[model samples]
Target: MEQTANKQTRLSQRVRSIQPSGIRRFFDLASKMDNVISLGVGEPDFVTPWNVREASISSLERGMTAYTANAGLLELRVAISDYMNNRFQVDYNPDNEVLVTVGASEAIDLGMRSIINPGDEVIIVEPTFVSYAPLVSMAGGVPVAVGTTAASHFEVLPEDIEAAITDKTKAIMICYPNNPTGATISRAKLEQIATIVKTHDLIVFSDEIYAELSYEKDHVCFSSLPAMKEQTIVINGFSKAFAMTGWRLGFVLAPPDLLDAMLKIHQYSLMCAPTMAQYGALEAMRNGMEDIEKMTLSYQQRRNFFVKTAKEIGLPCHKPDGAFYAFPSIAHTGWTSEEFAEKLLIEERVAVVPGSVFGKGGEGHIRCSYATSLVNLEEALKRIGRFLEAHDIRGN
Candidate 1:
């Protein structure tokens, strides 16, 4: 009787409704296979900078293992404030307007839960980060997806965003340089989107985790726009730029009232971000700009090489201007994204993410992360060419 009861335990409907990450599914498959060249997960191949790691080690040596204040170390917060102002032209007060969390992922969750109410709607521009919609749903907000096509370079249009807005709409969440696509919007385009948000009086969750990796031009911080600071929540972290993915340090910049609400949830749920990571982040904020520039230049070179080789090998892809991904159209293969991914992995030992898993406008494509070494990417693309040739799919 006890066994049966345990087996029949009810889970939250929200948890049951969402599917596991498609990116991870392929990553696991690749991990289990021999000689597989994976282009699936979007992690930087570089290790965290030595100085940042040293700072964390120094803290541990000093016996600083106690939990920080609920909002995180004020010194770290102050550094983040200065960094934002200097790098992105956005000013956030450190004392009451900034909150550091475990990672950008946690920051995103806090933002969603703090603002969402049951039956409220949040407009999500896709193909987008996978966590955006699910987090909104888990927060009791309806996720309304607004699709952007490859033809538009995957930049969400202001008209499309306006059309998606309803009386129930409460916020708009955007990521650029976007995950999986590496697309960036111009300052003018962001200004237009800002107008729509202002007109509708909706909140904006702007994820700028990849800001320092842009190749073509400088990234425009959404909160830096005129009159947008009060209405926008800026989510950023050291994971991408500083190659500090394992450090788990990220932060939020919002108005004091909005930040206070997020802090309440963060305080109760997490207490504060890891103390050592805070010290490391403070070091990163102060001295990691050079490391970011070096890593970004390497990624840009890899991107150029990968995109060029992909087109030469019959995979048509847009030249990504930012971030480290190349979303190539696989429509010519006459296979669904998942089908192509599976066959490619099985036949050629190259692992990539199926586009359909990223939501609307992703059906005929696959996302390839160039965050790995050029040697690995070259091998992967060469194998992909063989797969295409065997399938008799010709490039346009």
Candidate 2:
């Protein structure tokens, strides 16, 4: 009898090295339980706006099911270019510089694969996104995490970024209006960071999927900074800002050479983004500004209510300037972030993501997304209050 090959050994070492997402683990756990109030997932509670949905349906009616160009539909690319120019004062040649992707997630993967050589180090600002480091690792690059704390509202400092740079440092990945923490960087600070990147002669991958969601101030697009456009790869999509997560449409804006490299990877792997989604995204960019405003206002309202209620319940939460999350410190409970989250899920039926999963400096915090309905938010907050009181975890 022939000896069976070891299945574990057959798998790639890189695939085995990374663990499954911690956020998905909690989300899946909560999904299996009855009456569980989940604040774990970062998805919008709102559905795609009727106009945008209609556009996709219309495309289907027109029998527009064929594959688009490998670089995506030219019209959609034009719309994206126009949107960026009009809204953020950034310009890109749609034909050569923009590539529509499966999602912002795919754009990130492509960006890393395109630029990262073996052993190259990419600086990731964390407690930000979970996928950044793993993607870097998968691309044969090293992920160097630069942490930010709640005391500073989770801001990524220029000095910290500079300190982490080395001869191998090739790129820096930044997600502003950050996930989990909802922290945004100021233009002054970003300019400083831009200067550092230029001085170090490094590239930047700017994930601005949440750019349209800023509540307190206008978001500064990194690529718009003087002399920064050539060095920056901007990743964005219809998911977060337009409430089109299910559409799986995103785009990347970069210089022609870099875009050409990324497009080669995209063509071989994805071919193109969904054709119907492209039509829908075109409508969103052309006619969906009001829809974005409506959603942002709703998120801001929910954010305000959630932050206020969390503080009242003895959870010290920083008021988020953007996005739909409140990063509240659970330190007073005398529990690790995972411990508090797990116990709260079991005892209170309210599910939150452990802060530790977001990398270093995330301990003693729990990420609670305010993207659910007001009624759900209210019930979740009340249950959290009850759990804190029972554990005698009043704020210090």
Candidate 3:
């Protein structure tokens, strides 16, 4: 009976093939301990702006607790469209081209599943968000990783991307300012990539969840490039920039055909995004500019501090142009990425993620999020410095 039960309950090959999230593994470990200063997760420490929260509360009081249209509340979709145009220089018809989702994550998954077929190859630039490869694999597509190094500030080379392409190649996925590395691509380079995409006639999935958090230069939307709109799927959300991670609100912009395909999956699976969160997001879209500016400035300050401190502490780190992460090489310690992360967590009670989990070219590095308060960052840095000294890896 036991043997029969095991055989009948076998998991799907896709699910079995992927390992669990490395970020969540360390987070789970830290949750069990006391006084741990965690720089593991990329979530902001800020509260959702009062007005945004109040809008959602008001919706609940008004008894607005039901499902929205499968494409999301039309008002929210319109707001997202307007915001995209004004903020990122991108335009999409809210009527047919925009689809609100549970979060940027769901939008990405829908985009992948909507376009990818069995054996199709999607080029993934790494170290990137942990989800890109797994989601592609889950959608029955093959993930081809093209790694970038710190010497280039982790920016992908266009020639390398072109080399990775072939007949089976269907799409290319990119995130900037990237998670784990926090690197942003320049417009000249993006235009160069656009030429390659057009020449090869491929799709591009641009995950710009951190667009508002850029520290160096303004973000260049991939779809905003000339003639590239039809060939791109833009994935963005309010979670990171709006400090509304718990609200689970995100939206996508794609051509009408692709949008319709994703909507079909969303309707059957998710129905729509949460109703109250939609109202909250509506308010955020309308009056959230000041909040974004304030939060971004704070993050830039923290980024400056964290990068400087990481270098001073004997870890070689590149100053990231956007996002809140600092990827520092721990090669000097002669410890593998996992070993450095684990030992630091155990001895110093400071939690950071091992870079290897972010995929190719991530070895001998660790990702530290500077999204927490400056006070917490100061303390965490002190602990890290002490830990490094104990190991005789102090700065030069």
lDDT by residue (tens digit), candidate 3, 104-176 = 9999999999999999999999998999999999999999999999889999999999999999999999999
**In candidate 1, what are the lDDT values of residues 1-396, reduced to their tens digit?**
988766556767788777888778888888999999889878899999999999999999999999999999999999999999998888889999999999999999999999999999999988988899999999998999999988998988889999999999999999999987899988989999999989989899999999999997789999999999999999999899999898888999999999999999999999999999999999999999999999999999999999888899899999887888899999887889999999999999999999988896788999999999989998998899888889889586
Q: Point out the higher-scoring one by lDDT: 1 or 2.
A: 2
Q: What is the TM-score of each candidate against the true structure?
A: 0.98, 0.98, 0.98
Reference-based lDDT, each prediction: 0.92, 0.93, 0.93
lDDT tens digits, residues 1-396, model 2? 233447767888999899898888888888889999999978899899999999999999999999999999999999999999999999999999999999999999999999999999999999978899999999999999999987788888899999999999999999989997999999998999999999999999999999999998899999999999999999999999999999999999999999999999999999999999999999999999998999999999999999999899888999888988889998877899999999999999999999999997788999999999999999999999999899888794
Overall local distance difference test of candidate 2:
0.93
Candidate 1, run of 10 with poorest lDDT: 4-13
For TM-score, candidate 2 versus 3, the one ahead is 2
Residue 353 accuracy (lDDT) in model 1: 93
User: Model 3: which ten-residue window has the lowest total lDDT?
Assistant: 4-13
